[model samples]
Target: MRTVIHKLFFVWDFDKEEKWLCDMAAKGFTLVSVGFCRYEFEKCDPGEYGVRLQLLNHRLHHPESQHYLSFLEETGAEHVGSFLSWIYLRKRTSEGAFELFSDFESRIKHLNRIILMVISIVAANLYIGIFNILMCFFYHNEANYLGFINLAIGLIGSVGIWKLLRKRKKLKNDKQIFE
Candidate 1:
């Protein structure tokens, strides 16, 4: 009746995540909730629903969030769940395709926001990695293992940063097409 999936994806890869959710919906698995990197899906009629993702920087309890959720509900989108700043919504496929941002400018702005968030995370990881490396060099103890962990974190963050920057550049170049 219900299935759970564990997966991890960078925040900037939201498009991929949305596509995966849509694929699941097309296979009769409707998403019920999301916890961290876990997804809970309930079996339903195939092609019955379409999933959409919305990014809201506001806290869950914020009045702006409540108002936005209300507006989405009015538009026939059901609020399934939220993780951090991401809101998961679903709507009946028969109602037509669900798109949160209809204009090119809005899409660009959304991508810019995501890019900035990724940059901040990358910076934090880089700082921690440098600090750990310096400590390991000065202390020269068994705690050096932490330096390797930090290095890995930094590398992962750098990859995310590179991907986000490339994505932003591509979006900017393709902006004219959207216009």
Candidate 2:
């Protein structure tokens, strides 16, 4: 049997999303698919699988992505699903915990990739918003409403990017402390 749940989280809150997925798995709900903010879970024995989330910088159609997925599969991790640039993977708990990056340096590099992605997105949104606002002023028409909306979205993206940068900074500091 399958169950579906609806929930939304910002891209920057991926840790929270991963934790939620893991919690569902702990309760016998193995994630089968995810679209938009909805998650489809299949019934399974509690603690049957351990889940891991990864940010893939490459496009899904990229040849390197296939190689990366194949590498992970060779290591016993199953690629369950992918959305945008994020990939979901699972491994049987009996096999041990699922860890994609074992070393602190690799983990830091992964986080840096995520931070760069978020920054790029935020910059793009801001640029679009400014352009829209300029167009609205020049046209003096209904486009003003859309301009405002775009500005709001850009503001939200900026905030999200700020939060991600802070997280990245913290991770770097922690790495320094460890080394």
Candidate 1 lands at a TM-score of 0.91
Q: List the residue pairs that clash in candidate 2.
A: none
lDDT of each: 0.85, 0.84
RMSD of each: 1.6, 1.6
For candidate 2, write residues 64-153 as lDDT tens digits. 999999999998889888888789988888888888887668877888888788777767777877888887788765665665666677
Best by lDDT: 1
lDDT of 2: 0.84
**Number of clashing residue pairs, candidate 1:** 0
C-alpha lDDT of residue 106 in model 1: 81
Over 4 Å off, model 2 = none
Worst 10 residues of 2 by lDDT: 141-150
Q: 116 in model 2: Cα distance from truth in Å?
A: 2.0
